[model samples]
Target chain A: MSTAPTTEKGRRTRARIVDAAAELFYERGVSATGLGDVIAASGTGKGQLYHFFTDKGDLVSAVIRHQVEGTLAPQRELGLHRLADLQEWARQAVLQHERSPVMRCPLGSLVVELSNRNADAASALEAGFAQWRELMSGWIAQLQRRGEARTDLPADDLADSILAAYQGGLVLARSRGDLRPLETALAMAIEGIGSRRAPAGRHRAHG
Target chain B: MSTAPTTEKGRRTRARIVDAAAELFYERGVSATGLGDVIAASGTGKGQLYHFFTDKGDLVSAVIRHQVEGTLAPQRELGLHRLADLQEWARQAVLQHERSPVMRCPLGSLVVELSNRNADAASALEAGFAQWRELMSGWIAQLQRRGEARTDLPADDLADSILAAYQGGLVLARSRGDLRPLETALAMAIEGIGSRRAPAGRHRAHG
Candidate 1:
């Protein structure tokens, strides 16, 4: 074993393994997947896998990080600037869930599965959630700066509610095998935000 | 042949088994719990359990029904008359989750675990959810009549959102092994509802 695989190739291999693991983990829960499955899906031999990650827990942590970064990149790139366009942002979020109906958010699923079982996994999940919350909070703050969202609710709490509803919508959609709940919940949440600026009498429900 | 155990004592034993199964199912999950575990926890023998329940699935169905009724009865007793007291309602809901930090919602948990695997179990889960939705929708409608909630969002969608958030909060709380997420989510949701009547003015962030 003269020289280890080149750093570039090793990086590529690790990414491959993580991507494969993410897909498998989403389809079947983390508790149900195995190292063999990861290896087979990634098309990397056991030696390469072992070289890259010390154990299954290590691999799962990598997968969680990969998924968090992958999912967050889009929101940061496109959503940050579009905070004022609440309707469009809501539509995009709903579409994202509809696009992957069978596979709900992997970060959420992983958190539920591994939170109690593995401390490492729980930490990884918390990191992912914190990243999401921070991104969302920043977006909300931007909206406030633009006079888009209500300044009444603290930006952070509002951000948290939005995220909570989004996650909740995903769960409802998955359970019902329907996307209407997600659509309705998002629409209502956005409406809740917009209503903050309406006149007292016009503060009617917006279902 | 011995007489079938239909006596009062036999009925009590069967009820105990179902209650124990429901508790274990909620805590450890349906798939992880076994009939033997139920037998041990319920202080019932294998033959007695089989006599009461045809199989594990049968017992699971019974447990689902029992939990559904258990949850529903309290809400029914609380009555829709107090729907206007959103703050107290929200507080009570949050307190319910706080009371049992480790125990998940049995019906919701069952829906997630069994919806993908067993048809009968899925049906049972569906019925429970349907009943729950119905109960909530009824409460919301009553609130509308009492001028508590605006008729803007349909009762069904509003009920669904509340239920969805509750389920999502449970998942979030379980993942963190803490109840703050659940509490925060519920409090924010109630605040959103309360803010419905406010004019374009700043209110303190609830969470």
Candidate 2:
């Protein structure tokens, strides 16, 4: 029902709508947020909204994609090559949670609501999570090659485990309105990585 | 607006309404489900529904309590005195996910939808998580006294970390429609608990 933007102005218009929608969805939830809310929040006309999105489902998918990009952009930038980077990643998450009013993962929050109900949004989220796992796995693989991590466990599994610790930690943190659960969970997960490890003789020598 | 049930029949009627609401909330989310949906799902009259619940918010709090009891019932029954018991806990979770139509923790699924928006529901959920964590920590403390777990780590942190792995792993598993992440994350978390432990020499000799 909608077409991709052809011009810079069109792209900007669509971006505005999606950004506004993403905020509303994160705060109120996709089920509770209406198109009228998005249009009002974005300061865009109904015509502009319809021109860019076919329906609420379409808009939800776009928001999911946007959230995926936002989540991955910073993670992709991180080297994730050393234990210190992994430690810093956990530290930053706890710090961010402390500063924020509500502790919800922009993407993780969407999964429970959309995964079973919305196919398009679920696929977008699945792809995003896969990319996240692959990036972390790549970093772990590199560390394994340098004898900096445990070679006994597959990098893919290790990455997934770390990801699980983070996701589960955030849920507990949100429920309790505290950071201790997230902090302890991430710390233990990072510590688990160093368990039964190959000595990082070569990697340690450089630093 | 609703009063406590003074009779057995009143208790059953209230429980029926709460059960119906919990299912609809889990499947469709709290925002999308209405009181009418509960009435239809429960085959109860409006008068009965209103008699049991002051409003949807009251019903949501009741559902949270129901879910907490459901989540903790099985956990309390487990002795959780050894590593094998921990492994079994993880295995049962993965197996349950495989068997169920949707992958979600009964209580966890509610946290994101209600944690920020509803104060009463938030308090109920926070109390449930705290109770759950305390139960897990109690088990870990018992293990520590028996030299079955790492004493270097606090029982509370270990419990929280394991909980995080279970929760985060479930989110990833639900997103991926696969069990590997949940399985790996939990396995690694349990493995971490036994890391650098005091030897269970006495228990081992008895075995």
Candidate 3:
């Protein structure tokens, strides 16, 4: 709800508030995490928190948007964009899970908690998912155009399937404190892209 | 925590507390809901509540089990079993989404909130997912043996994929308040079962 800060100090303060809010929301859930807690954690006064956010609803939307970017930044740079094999993405997902075995998909966890609870927050969550799914679907489309993926379904459908599997896998993974479900689901999803039929003779053994 | 109810009246009181707690948990969230609210909503005293549940943690596991059965009962009876076409299941799922457009998956919503917060509750959620997956996998295995489904991938993989897609679809669907994501994801999943080869002439000619 607040306008972008013109000063560097103001921007830093705003970012600090969002980060504190996100952590509290993730750890204790939205309704239980109050502005007082956020103020305390961020070490910002009520005047500054209010200057940045119109209210709790406004802050929750900002938090959801913040979490979506945090969750996707690495995948865009480190995992998906430069990888030659989609399976590499799956492998990295497992490794990340091994590193942090208990956190739910940040955006996804927000969706379940806020989807039906707040209208403004729900729309923000929807926008976050759409942005992430668009990035994933763009990759699926590129693979399809190159004939490395299934043609029987629309690229959007294929992309949606993979995203769904991933989100669901995270739910099970976090619930079980195990990464196998995420690993298996992602592996099967990549297989669904038809990577196995990549003109078998074209890429000969290097050795 | 508390001992199992030994009398019919005690069992009913315990069930009432669980049902009321589940409603509050689903409406708000586990952390946001209080035992006092549950006791008030269920018309039970604090002593009665404690007679059945030792604490919030114990009640949460009960709530998850309760939610799981609630989600599966209709599917087990009117959906998924003895269906000549897997598409039927997808269609019904879409219809159910239409009927209940605003609510999150009961078990799944609990998962995003409690998975990492409590180990005992997380195990209960995991057991719930496994029970649902097991039922679906049993059906998939039977279909494979009858030559009505894909034989290339293991039935457990197929089942897990379907479950993951379904869970993910619910997340997306709830986030957007649109049924298309769920519909598309499920349609693609049923197709993954490789159902096109169901006896060329036996079930054909009707079209």
What would the TM-score be for candidate 2 when compared with the true structure? 0.93
Q: Give the fraction of true interface contacts kept by model 2.
A: 0.72
Chain A TM-score by candidate, in order: 0.87, 0.91, 0.86
* DockQ of model 3 vs. true complex: 0.34
Cα lDDT tens digits for candidate 1, A1-207: 112346898878877888888988887666567889999999999988888788888888888888899888887777554444656766888887667645366777666555355678778788788788788778777877776676777776666667667767776676677777777766666655542555444443221
Instruction: Work out the TM-score per prediction.
Output: 0.82, 0.93, 0.85
Ordering by DockQ: 2, 3, 1
Task: Report, to 2 decimal places, the DockQ of model 1.
Answer: 0.29
lDDT of 2 by residue, A170-207 (tens): 99999988888898888888777763522233223221
Q: Which residue ranges in model 2 land beyond 4 Å of their true spot?
A: A195-207, B195-207
**Each prediction's DockQ against the real complex:** 0.29, 0.50, 0.34
Name the 10 consecutive residues with the lowest summed lDDT in model 1 chain A: A198-207
lDDT of 1 by residue, B165-194 (tens): 677676666666777667766666654444
Which one wins on TM-score?
Answer: 2
What tens digits encode model 3's per-residue C-alpha lDDT throughout A33-108? 8899999999999999999899999999889889888877876774443225567777876786687655577788
Instruction: Tell me the spans in candidate 1 whose CA falls farther than 4 Å from its real position.
Output: A1-13, A43-55, A82-84, A101-103, A115-117, A198-207, B1-17, B34-36, B43-59, B115-117, B174-178, B191-207
Worst 10 residues of 3 chain A by lDDT: A198-207
The best candidate by DockQ is 2
Best by lDDT: 2
Clashing residue pairs in candidate 2 are A168-B168
Q: Which ten-residue region of model 2 chain B has the weakest summed lDDT?
A: B198-207
Q: How many clashes (backbone N, Cα, C below 3 Å) per candidate?
A: 0, 1, 0
For residue A55, model 3's alpha carbon misses the true position, in angstroms, by 2.6
